[model samples]
Target chain A: MTPRLFQRTASAVLVVLITVSVLFPLAWMAIAGFKGRNEVLRSPFQFFPDMWRFDNYVDIARDPEFTRAMGVTFAGALIFTALSLVVNSLAAYAFARLEFRGKRFWWVYCVMPMFIPMMAILLTSFMVVTKLGMLNTMAVLIIPGVASGAQMFFIRQFYLGFPVAVEEAAMIDGASRWQIFLKLFLPQSAAPFVVMGIASYLAFWNAYVWPILTITDPNLTQIMQFLGTFRSARGNDWGMLMAGSTLASLPTILLLLVFQRFIVNGVRISGIK
Target chain B: MALTPTLAPGPQTADAGRSARGRRGRVKTPPHRRDNRTAYLMIAPMVILLGIFVMWPLVYSVYLSTYEINFYRGSTFVGLQFYRYVLESPDFWHSIVVGLYYSALTVPAMIIIALLLASFIKTLSRRAAAFMKTTVYLPTVVSTVVASVLFVLIYQDEGVANWLLSLISFGPVNWLNDPQLALPAIAVPGIWLGFGLTTLILLAALLDIPESYYEQAALDGAGFFARLWYVTLPLLKNVLLYLFVTGFTLAIQMIDLPLIMTNGGPSEATNTPNLYIFNTFRDVTPYATSYSLTASLLLFVVIGAISAVVFRLVRSDKAIDG
Candidate 1:
């Protein structure tokens, strides 16, 4: 083969190899969700099940604890996303558009928490939540996450690049600052808002340590903690475990498939910039 | 003032225009004050939330480090005793060493593998690249819990990992239960989960490199390796360093994967510092809080110093680039 052909063929092979490696475990999980416990344990490399089982999904759906945990996770993610957008956007707008004294100092103050690893503050944050008498309640999950430095930073970066002429024109028309922000800025910056919203939603949904620590009530438990404890309790039941895993992962995976572009853009913008 | 003549003149044109200009100037000055008010109003919620949750806790963590907190009783002062105790504890040192070892295993492996995958994908057709990108990135969307569960199934003695090993005539390996193999086994999923994001970031960096640079290199009789070395690596330096720093930070703060997969099993071989902190907090004794808080403070200091140095290096690179 010519050198170009050789290179092209090599690239294709490597790409296929990577695709398989990435997908196999996920594919196995999905497949194992349909397998019997015995088949899952005995024939680990079996590509297909002898018969598909819809009972696992039905069982998981009927499980009150699983359903309750899912509801808690969903509500937590939604509330966290909405509140984060409001709080972070307002702060971002102030940092981006308004001229204020001590702007630089406050900017640093707001953004500094991004550097402090969340694990490092786990205990103190738990204490703070405990002191507020918010433990085992949804408030502990939602309130602490309402203000995110990273979200504020990302939104601020988006706003900084926004055209000031639009807001300027609105001001010239006797529009109040609030009116201009409500009418113009929000509509214009919808993309970044969605990006941050989805990002925060996924984060809140996937949060494990905080929820595990705070919520001991089975009814208030998040999906991750539920799935983890469920696995530990029924370690030998691969079929049921994989079924629960698939259920827990389905929403985020679907979200990713739908908003893959925005997710990639968000990661790149936040990480690289 | 320069554009004042563009406006229509009225009966009291001169006075009206002068007053209009005066009014404009006066309007501008208070809006600055109004903007300040608005700014403060806008930032209040975030400021309050971050202060109560983050800033206060940060200070409280330090204070808690110096006290012996008991659940039954109140906190008692124990200035720097816990700190000294933690520093002297072999378990604390072991956890730090494990954290470093995990970082050493994952960071370079993630960077190199991610870079290769990114470069390879860059050579594919657009459609093929998109498919590969999505497939590779699929793992990242899976939560650490889910990933850990999946890997646990695979690493079991009769699972796919051993099944694959048997193909090469090797015996079943105790991937997680064996202390010697636990850390490395756990690092496998960590690398797998991490490389996709790193690859995507590197791909972004790679795509940002102008095609003209490659063409120019080719014109200068540069081969693929020469072009990559001369034109790509230099441009990718910042991104590579970024990946390294982030990867290092993540590897050190690893909690969920080890927590779920091994739970620092087989005698705490895979017990990261974060896990150590976690377990310390789980201790129900009166002095557990102080010890855990002290360990957390140590972690914070070490991570802070490392980040500060890495950030300094990044800033210096930007200086050189500018």
Candidate 2:
């Protein structure tokens, strides 16, 4: 074979190897969700279940705690994403376009949180939330997390790249600042907002430590925390565990499938910038 | 002329408005002043949230670190005692060591694997490249908790990992239950979860490299390895540094995966600093709060110093000019 053909064949083999390695665990988990307990444990090497079972999914649906955790997860994601977009975008817009006294100070202050690891502040932040009488509620999950320095920074980068002429034309047409921001800037910023929104949503959805700390009530448990406790409680039930894992991962996998381009673009832009 | 009054209102107001409009158009005062007010309004919510959540908690963590508090009784100031205690504790040092070891094991492995995968993907046809990218990146969106659960099944004694090993005539080895193997075993999922993002970033950096460099090297009769070493790696220096710094930062804070899979068990071999802090707080002992706070503060300082040095090194030398 020619050198080019050899290289091409070698790369193709590597690609197939990588694809299998990446998908194997996930595919196994999905398939195991449909297997019986005996089947899962006895034939761990088997690619196919001897008999398909919907019992685990049926059990998950029938359990109120599991269902409640799912609800809490979705609600947390939605509220956190909405609040983060509004708060971060407004701050980002100001940082991008508007001039104010102490602007540099505020900008630095807002971006400082990104440098400090969240674990450093976790204990004190819990105390602060307790002091505010917000602990043990859903408010604790959503409120403190709504303001993200990283998201604000990304959105500000996006806005900085946007042209100012559009806003200038709107101002010349007698539009107020708010009007121009709403009609022009906001419309132009859908991509970044969607990017930030999905990011915030995923963060809230996947959160474990904070939710576990703040939420004591079983009914209010988030999906991740619930999964941890569920695994401990049903340590022997591989079928249920796989089913729970599948349920926890389904939303994100679907989101990836539907918004593959947006997710990729978002990660690239955020990392490169 | 007739519409002037309607557009600008009464004569006195019209002159004032005309002056204001003229100032807005030419000078930077009128519109800027108005925007300043609007800007303040726009940023108010974020400012308030940060003050209450981020800024206050930052100062409060330091203050809390100096105090020894008990839930049953009130608190008393124990200035520098907790910090000293934490410094003296072997467990604290062990946690840090484990964190560093974990970072050492995972970050370089992830980077090398990701770089190779990314470079190979770059050589593929567009359709093949896209498919490879999607499959690899799919794990990135999976929650750490879910990924841990999935891997726990695979790493079990009778699980697929051992099954695959048996295909090569190796005996079944306990991945998570053994102390010596626990940390490295846990690093498997970490690498799996991380390589996709690293690959994507490296791919982007690779794509940004000009093709002329490769062509010039080829014209000089450089082989593939020579071109990769002289052309690609040099161009990718900054991006590689970025991946290293961010990857190290992330690896140090790993909590959910080990917390779920092993719960820092097998004689605490996999206990990260973040997990140690969590357990310290959860235990609620007499000085647990202060201890946890001090550990966290120490972690912050170490991470901050390391990141500062890395940024300085990476920023000082630019291999590729934009």
**Fnat for each predicted structure, in order:** 0.54, 0.53
Calculate model 1's interface RMSD in Å.
14.4
CAPRI classification of candidate 2: acceptable
- What digit string (tens of lDDT, one per residue) describes model 2 on residues A1-273? 999999888888888888887898898988888988777867448878888889988897778888889988898788888988899889988877776777769988887777778888888898899899997788898989888777887777677667778778887889987787788778888778776776777788888888888888887889988887776776778888888888888887787777777755765565462
Q: Give candidate 1's TM-score.
A: 0.92
Stretches of candidate 1 above 4 Å error?
A: A1-9, A271-273, B1-34, B318-322
Q: Which 10-residue span in candidate 2 chain B carries the lowest summed lDDT?
A: B1-10
Output the lDDT of residue A229, model 2: 76
Q: Candidate 2: which pairs clash?
A: none
Q: What is the C-alpha lDDT of each candidate?
A: 0.81, 0.81
lDDT for position B71 in model 2: 73
Residue A178 of candidate 2: its Cα lDDT?
78
- Stretches > 4 Å off in candidate 2: A1-11, A271-273, B1-34
